[model samples]
Target: MRNRHIATALLAASLLLFAAGCKKKTPVAPPPPPPPPPPTVVEKAPAAVISSFTAEPSTIVRGEASTLRWSVANATEVTIDNGIGAVSASGSRQVYPTSNTTYRMTAKGGGGDAVAAVTVAVTTPPPPPPPPPAAKASLEERMSREIQDIFFDYDKSEVREDSRATLQRNADALKTILSEFPSAVVSIEGHCDERGSAEYNLGLGDRRSASVREFLIQVGVPGDRLKPISYGKEKPVCTEESESCWQRNRRAHFVGVQ
Candidate 1:
């Protein structure tokens, strides 16, 4: 008892200072909820817009045809090239290119691709105009363009009553050139005028070509298509002793044989 050990060591230091001031502070775990704020990102949508590509007759002429209009926006797929594949975004197509061409268009979605181009022009065609100039191929060139020649009177030829209307218009133009050359043969030559006597002017030019082959066989021509001849006084178409040069060497001459 040293004074009861100083009051029991001051009551064990006053119960260790009231158990270190009631000892109960060990709960501080609420600072781990600040690591969950990094998850929220999503963006994508923009690219695909051509809104118009055209060629409605941009020019064409080789069997002609052209038409390829188009329009697009934020597409999901659209295409066009030479062979014009998959397409439908507001369209029209009818091409027939055979020479010059250039056409491209592509539009795709999901924010990706887009492009447009248009060009179509081609031409060439002209030639036709040259055929018209041919006609006059003989029958003695159509009887010298339709026969005509008759004269006589100075040493007389029986048919000279003004040569009976020029021997009935030379027997209607030799019956229209013997009805178109029916094996043609017409010689009635009888000319004379150097004042006769080349053997009595060949019997007065064989009675002036047998009186124009008996007036063209009484007007129906065809004493077997006539053939009387006699170049009496030797073909004197006017040796000019005059009587209008012996009436132009008395005549009744027509000749076309083949």
Candidate 2:
């Protein structure tokens, strides 16, 4: 009976412990599963860095057009200040800016946003073209080869009747110049071919120049308007030994000095 009582007491104690353990209790579930992992919200990485931008023409001419384009390594969306033609884009777009303009490109996403700006300038047209005019090429001297000189037959040494018409033309040209430009000074250079001795040639040269001047004065040109010098054979328009060249050398050259 004693053993049976002991065994019964032990059974009762075990039952009481099992009843206490079976009582209703709050569930301690792993901190409520950490608040359901906060809805497993995982933010994405920020957008890439946009160091700068590129432009079609950084400095464009006043009449030309320019485009301000931007770029980012990786982006979700892009926005630009693109004034006057401002626009928003998911990736990229183009812009043609008229006047001086600046564009800011922004990349926005989980990793954050980057920015870059591109600028373009306008230019003005160049100055107007210039004009071309005539050059002022007037003669300060009357010694152009355009005028002809008259020569007398050798040794007879007088202005011949036949040469009078030729002398008249030369005298007329000189007279016109002396009358038109009083400030201009005239010098008549005389010459001779190589027929005579140098001394005789020199004297003959002077005689020829003086004769021309005298004829000019007789034809209404003032004597004070003429000055004469003899070149002899020292100076010749052409040095050829030909008769034609020699004849050309035997003449007076008129020059004007301002």
* Winner by lDDT: 1
Assess every candidate by TM-score: 0.26, 0.44
Q: Candidate 2's residue-wise lDDT over 147-204, tens digit each?
A: 4666654432356687788778767776666666677777878788866678887888
RMSD of each: 20.1, 11.6
lDDT of 1: 0.80
Tens-digit lDDT string for candidate 1 (167-225): 78778878888777888888888888887678877878777888888888898988887
User: lDDT of model 1 at residue 223?
Assistant: 83
TM-score of 1: 0.26
Give each model's clash number.
Answer: 0, 10
For model 2, the superposed segments whose C-alpha errors exceed 4 Å read 1-137, 140-146, 152-157
